[model samples]
Target: MHLSHPTPLQNIMESKTCSRRGILLPFNSYSSHKKDAQHCIFCDTTFPLRNFKGKAVCPTCSQNILKLFLEREVR
Candidate 1:
């Protein structure tokens, strides 16, 4: 007998919010946005994507914020 299961690629393809290259979607080929978020990461703060002077925020803080934001949406 043979059985079938959803492969990792299939699972991703089936997702509605599937993003690629950390961009909007479908265009981003790198798929760098496939990251997980943590709970209680952001206590009380609104994290902006890019800060003033067009410079990005601190890497550590940015990562934490991204995780928190994503986790919240997932729930």
Candidate 2:
């Protein structure tokens, strides 16, 4: 059997296997923009973007503010 040298490929992303569904997705060595990360305006904390869609505040801060408003309304 004979073997040839590997060709030089440019900007090829590595593949990563999903543990749950066993799907193959492209994985990059360096991340420019992570989709999951969202900066909460109220608490100034970083959290998942899924929690608040088109909103600046995080879940915790929003809930706390709601509770305070409800308490005042009941009084």
Could you give candidate 2's per-residue lDDT for residues 1-75 as a string of tens digits? 544743344213221332345668987644545664557755677653235456666667766867756877999
> Which runs of model 2 end up more than 4 angstroms from their true locations?
1-21, 27-30, 34-37, 49-53, 67-75
Could you tell me how far off, in angstroms, the CA of residue 29 lies in candidate 2 after the best superposition? 5.9
Stretches of candidate 1 exceeding 4 Å from the true structure: 1-41, 44-63
Clashes of each: 1, 0
Using TM-score, give the best candidate's number: 2
Clash number for candidate 2: 0
Query: Candidate 1 residues 1-75, lDDT tens each?
Result: 554987788787778565544645446443454343222224423343335235445445566766766888999
True-vs-predicted CA distance for residue 60, candidate 1, Å: 7.1
In candidate 2, which residue pairs get closer than 3 Å at backbone N, Cα or C atoms, i.e. clash? none
Clashing pairs in 1: 21-31
